[model samples]
Target: MAQYSPQYEMNRYINHYFTSHACPPQETQAWFSTPYAMMNYCQQNRIGAILPERFLQAMGIAKGYCELEPPLRLPCYLVYKKDNPKYATIQVFVDYIRRVYHIKK
Candidate 1:
């Protein structure tokens, strides 16, 4: 179990899950700040990493990692300042993203 920054939501989720699941010390041996670093470490060490599914897809090696039972889901959100003047442009961009990703508000 490689550790990422405590600030990232994914890291928080991973930490919470691991605390309840009680991973062995051997499994929780490394720490890194980015997905790329974690992925590279896992590859070189022949270990598994708890990474965003998209990361694996982006690396073109989704099949390389062994996925565990009971997959994790992370919630995503789009946020902006309510007082911003570029509301229309932001809405258009948001709409484009939703359409591209098939997301519903």
Candidate 2:
């Protein structure tokens, strides 16, 4: 499996998924920091990739990559200063994000 290096936030979750699953161990064929590069490589080489939904959307599904069923669920959290004076704007942004992702904070 292809492994991403350079330590992006998603890398932690990807690592966790691999370690927790019974799938074959990931032997790094290439280290890609960005989703585009990894998606391109996977497409050209006929290899499977673990990519985020945003990346897949950006790359276009017409590339003929089959999305596995029951998408990988990664836990996420939104954190902010509770005592900050500009809490309203933060709350609005947080609410927008929750709506987009369909998640509760």
Candidate 3:
């Protein structure tokens, strides 16, 4: 089987979570900005990923229990709507993820 990159797995998790929750795809982009940002939001909000530990392990990410560089992304859209200023901040993160991780619709 082809192993997915940590970033790719994170994208799938985000997409699945938002879609299952009936969130529009556009709204999803507005929600997390990027996978890394989403992870940060999850950490802050106690919203673990589908396979929280596994996902983190795959990404080489560590949370409160581990000693690692804190992920440097933010979930601006998690607390605001698309029309809000924070949404723009999220959009920047999303763009970065897309460019850096090659996330596609």
Better of 1 and 3 by TM-score: 1
Alpha-carbon deviation at 21 in model 2, angstroms: 2.5
Overall lDDT per candidate, in order of appearance: 0.77, 0.74, 0.52
lDDT of 3 by residue, 1-105 (tens): 111244554566555655666767532222443546667666677444333455577788665444223322323333457787678788887788778967674
Better of 2 and 3 by lDDT: 2
Off by over 4 Å in 1: 18-26, 83-86, 96-104
lDDT per residue for candidate 2 within 17-104, as digits (tens), equals 6667765666778888877788888878857678876667765765566664546787767778899898999999888989998976
TM-score, cand. 3:
0.26
Kindly report which residue pairs in candidate 3 clash with one another: 33-94
Q: For this target, which candidate reaches the highest lDDT against the unseen true structure?
A: 1
Comparing candidate 1 with candidate 2, which one achieves the higher lDDT?
1
Better of 1 and 2 by TM-score: 1
lDDT of 1 by residue, 1-105 (tens): 676766777777776665667764335567788899998998889566788777799889857666745666667787899778998899999999999989988
Q: Order of candidates by TM-score, top first?
A: 1, 2, 3
TM-score of each: 0.69, 0.65, 0.26
